[model samples]
Target: MPISQAAQRLPDDAVYVRPRMAHYAAVSRQIMAALENISPSVEQASVDEAYLDVSGLERLIGPPETIGRQAKHIIKNTVGLTASAGIGPNRFIAKLASEYRKPDGLMVVHPHEVQAFLDPMPISALRGIGPRTAPALRQMGLERIVDVRQTDPALLERRLGLRLAQVILNQAHGRGSDEVQLHSVRQSISKETTFEQDIVDQARLRETLLWAAQEVGRTARREGLQGRTITLKIRLENFKTFTRQRKLPAPTDDDTVLYRQAWALYRESGLAEHPVRLLGLGLSDWQQDAPSQGDLFDTPSHPSEHAQTPQRDRRTRLFQTLDGISNKFGQNAITLGLRRKT
Candidate 1:
């Protein structure tokens, strides 16, 4: 809903303020960090929700229930907030189990109890069954998960496409992927903004790109990641979008390098001649345990190349200091000014 409509429907005592995305993002990062301590195979489904696969740690630690309790306790202690956990055979059953009890609750569904647990639930409780699909399922007398399981496969396949029908049937049987993907390198971290008005000034565009690069670099650093590719996105006033990319010699989580590379890509794209309606900056091709920037070229072929190490180290220290301040206070508490080119 639009803010205006939401305000109109609000009560007289309602006090709404603008969303603080950066603050929320910081908190989400903290929560994820706490979760990582529980299991190495943690998949972040969203900012607040995640799936942890504790497949073969029974001997090393404890059962799934104990692991779930520990996870909730760790999150509460570390992030100062309560978290819900659901332990099941697979992601689908686990998601349903998580919602079975809410507001600091833990529910564990074993393999033997999967059918008993899902049969009583509504068809809508199954993932991918939205408002439209729910109505269709209900019309077909598939009001519950058990109904879906009992319904004719050919009937469902004719109604909903073969793939979707099979998926729904599979979910009804409480079958889903047990794989919990760890941090994936294919995922890109990005920031983008659409201008209130189309901007023609090159300086303003560069400033926007720099800010976005800074944000991307900060997020990557927080996640302990570095990327070898820098991508720049530009949208002209006519709504035509263009993207340009460049690969770095080594992976980096430095805003300086990001900004320089992104800016270089933008210039090479030759789209700057048009007024820009939107600008974006992204870093991809993640390297989890990348070499430090200073050490990247440490085994320099020449003595002159070795001199760059100290400067790199100094810049790294400076950025680390900036990050510390930002984390302590706020994202905008300190920022590097982008100097205008002559």
Candidate 2:
């Protein structure tokens, strides 16, 4: 049945939901808090999914299945939501096990059972194997996960690209990474939006860039992060994507600085003359701590000297005030003047 039709068949009492960013953010925080109590090593895969490293907890928590059940109970009791748990030697196996029996189910894959567990599944079941790639694999007589495992890596590379084939081969043989990383390990934060229709107007494009920069800055501040590099991503109407990046003299979480850098990169791309389908802004090369304050006589290192000026300090304070107001009232309570469609 079509997903839309199935959704309509549900009773009116069913929670027909719409996407709300605040609600999702709250839930994500709750989930992270819950996991932090269970294991010190927790990797958030997405807003709704995560990976927990429970390797050394056997003595305290009993078995892997017991740990899974306890984790589920905590989430249900605390967050009012039930979570599916997957326990395995590696993340790939664990992720697959979790999805195999979902919606409040628990599945455990022991070290010895990894190959057997993967044998019957189709190639598409593997992570990173998209619909387009799956058919090509099947055409090569590699139908099941077992077939891919038995195939030669050299031949696989010849058919698929080198890097992707190696990743698939490693996954097929039950060799997968199990390191659950914390959020601090992330290298970059980005935001992108695809337009409903191609946009050609320079003003609209600039407004979109400003919005993307604002979002990146907001997220960075929330995460207590600041980056030196600001990257601009533009996808033309023909679906050709291009990216340009600029490094700042000092790391910053100021949206104004991010917007200016992104705007500069966008102009340098020479795509202003073409219609755009998508726009993105990213911040990377994170600083260990907040940017340091410079003395009056310090030589300027970057082209944007205004970043070290008192005006920039004032702008930063204004942004912080606006952020507070937005948090208390709502996201749309205040908007950047540049983001306004003029």
| Ten-residue region with minimum lDDT total, candidate 2 | 291-300
Write one digit per residue (lDDT tens) for candidate 2, span 1-342.
632355457775555333355577688889888888889888888889899989999998899989999999988987899889888999999999999898889999999999999999999888778978888898999989999999988999998999999999999989988887775457798877777667888888778877877788888887788888888988776567889988887787877777777877877788888888778899999886775333223455677875346755665677789889878997768778774522
In candidate 1 the C-alpha lDDT for residue 203 amounts to 89
Q: Candidate 1: lDDT of 207?
A: 85
Residue range 44-111, candidate 1, lDDT tens digits: 88778888878887777798888889999988887789888899999998988888899899999999
Residue pairs clashing, model 1 = none
Q: How many residue pairs collide in each prediction?
A: 0, 0
**TM-score of model 2 relative to the true fold?**
0.70
Q: What's the lDDT for all of these models? A: 0.83, 0.81
Off by over 4 Å in 2: 1-18, 131-133, 152-154, 157-165, 191-212, 228-251, 260-281, 285-307, 316-342
Model 2 local distance difference test score = 0.81
